[model samples]
Target: MTRHFSETEVVAILDDLNPARLRSFVAARVVTPLQTPQGQAFSEADLARLQLLCDLSEVYDLPDDALAMVMSLIDQLNTARGDMRALIQAVATEPDEVRGRIMTHVRSIRVTGRG
Candidate 1:
């Protein structure tokens, strides 16, 4: 059977987050923890994501707005990755010399102050 995490377990996992920030995340509905009449519960994914958020917010010192921007960028990157997967399916192989030539040209352009 699959396992979900409890709120306390989630809290314990993300020891870097302040209670106030955690509560704010709850209030923001960034993660929808399961809740009973007594209290809220969480999934393992929620715990993991909370830990990641704490790392960004505490260790990286990102403000809430900056975190939101980072999340938006991540979503965009995920979508781009999906698109890239589909595009790569059609490619046979990239020639190494061709790739190296493009890189060399790009470097030469940069050195010569050209776009």
Candidate 2:
């Protein structure tokens, strides 16, 4: 079973995080937690994201909007990486000739800067 953290526990875990800021982050949709009968429950992923947000805010002094934009870009990049991994796995299952052809096409696109 996955361990879920309450808001109080999350605040205690992250040094730079406070109740007000956590609430603000949630309000901004930066760190979404699961709602349960007990109240908001944070996953490990949420904990890591909260840490990252604290770093971004403290180190870069980013406003909420800027943080949201940065987070969105990060999320998009992660999605693209997952998609690329899936494509690579699919290509790996192909015959050698097909794989070679695909690699050649990819190299040509890279060389021509067309992709």
Candidate 3:
């Protein structure tokens, strides 16, 4: 089962996560914790993200807009990495001839506008 952290627990774990800052993070959609009847329950991922947000806010002194942009770029990079991994796996499944052809096509595309 996944472990969940209450607001107090989150604050305890991350000293920088004050109530006001937590509210701001929620408003900014930076960390979407699960809402229970008790209160907001954060997952491990949420906690990690919150820690990063804290670092960005305190250390980098990034404003909300700038932080959002940085996070967006990070998300995009992660997505691209996953896509590249899947593509590599798919390529690995192909025959040697097919792989060679694909490499040639890729090289040609890099050298010229068209493959």
Candidate 4:
């Protein structure tokens, strides 16, 4: 099981966000985590997401709404990737032309259904 981060650990991981950026992300509701009795609780995943937001801020000069849209698209892409990884692994285990044939058959099935 994944270990939950303590507040100190969370701060250590997230301290890369300078005070100004941290305020911006919090204001944008992009840095929210579960509040625990001791302190704020952030999943490790949030660290990665925050890093991506920081990168977007640096590279693209993304405003709040644009950053939100980019993050939303990132979520969509990540979901698609998870689905595709299993498919890709299955395809890799197949014989060389088998994958191609499967794609061909799928296309044919779709074409027939459309007709």
Local accuracy by lDDT, each model: 0.71, 0.97, 0.91, 0.77
lDDT: which candidate is best?
2
Better of 2 and 3 by lDDT: 2
TM-score of 1: 0.58
Q: What tens-digit string does per-residue lDDT give for candidate 2 at 1-115?
A: 8899999999999999999999999999998999999999999999999999999999999999999999999999999999999999999999999999999999999999886
Which candidate do you rate higher for lDDT, 1 or 4? Answer: 4
Candidates' TM-scores?
0.58, 0.97, 0.90, 0.64
**In model 3, how large is the Cα lDDT of residue 46?**
89
Worst 10 residues of 2 by lDDT: 106-115
* Candidate 4 colliding pairs, count: 0
Off by over 4 Å in 1: 34-39, 90-115
> Model 1 over residues 20-39: C-alpha lDDT tens digits?
77777777555678776757
Higher-scoring candidate on lDDT, 1 or 3: 3
lDDT of 3 by residue, 5-103 (tens): 998899889988898888888888877999999989999998999999999999989987787888888889999999999999999999999999999
Sum up the clashes in candidate 1: 0
- How do the candidates rank by lDDT, highest first? 2, 3, 4, 1
